[model samples]
Target: MKALLILLISAIITWTLALWKTTRVTSATELSSLGFGWPLQWIEQDQSRFQWASYPQDARLTFVKFDQLPAYVDWGLFAANVLIIACALLVIYFSFPLILRMFRK
Candidate 1:
């Protein structure tokens, strides 16, 4: 239950941040890179579309809007990423104590 709660909370927070940042962005050019551990920063480009991106560990840099595609695509990717990370964290959180106990013996 705790793990679920943690995951939900984490997802909500990350989604909120990403969504909020996304709103501030008007063009896809603002996103510089995609993948893990990239800090969100402003990068100017000629593109005028939207793309959904996910950054790890509160790092910035995610979301892009492209012409013709639905905004939901980006949001879906964002949600998936948030869930993946939350799940990973939940696993680590639960396992850490057990791992420590094993090593202590």
Candidate 2:
């Protein structure tokens, strides 16, 4: 139960963070700045740009088309995040016992 809870929490957190990061990433520079950006970019590169209510043609009006985003982008980021987060969780789980023993000394 404890391990399940840990994996659940970690997955939720990792996936949420991945979604938030990818939603705003429109260009290579933005995605490349992230540690997981390379893999996420590798998954897809067909980001669509759009402009809404562009009376003034401001930067805010012209942005990536998040509403019409592709499925691969979302799922790709989530998959990468899950894999990375799961690996970290595994390391922590396997080493936690050794850490506790060291603190006992």
Q: Which candidate comes out best when scored by TM-score?
A: 2
Candidate number of the best lDDT: 2
- Candidate 2, 13-96: lDDT as tens digits: 664554444334444443323232322332343333443332322121112555643323456566566667777888988999
Q: After superposition, how far is residue 91 of candidate 2 from its true place, in Å?
A: 0.8
lDDT values for all models: 0.48, 0.50
Q: List residue ranges in candidate 1 displaced over 4 A.
A: 1-4, 12-73
What's the true lDDT of residue 24 in model 1? 41
* Model 1 poorest ten-residue lDDT run: 35-44
User: lDDT score of model 2?
Assistant: 0.50
Q: What is the lDDT of residue 16 in candidate 1?
A: 57
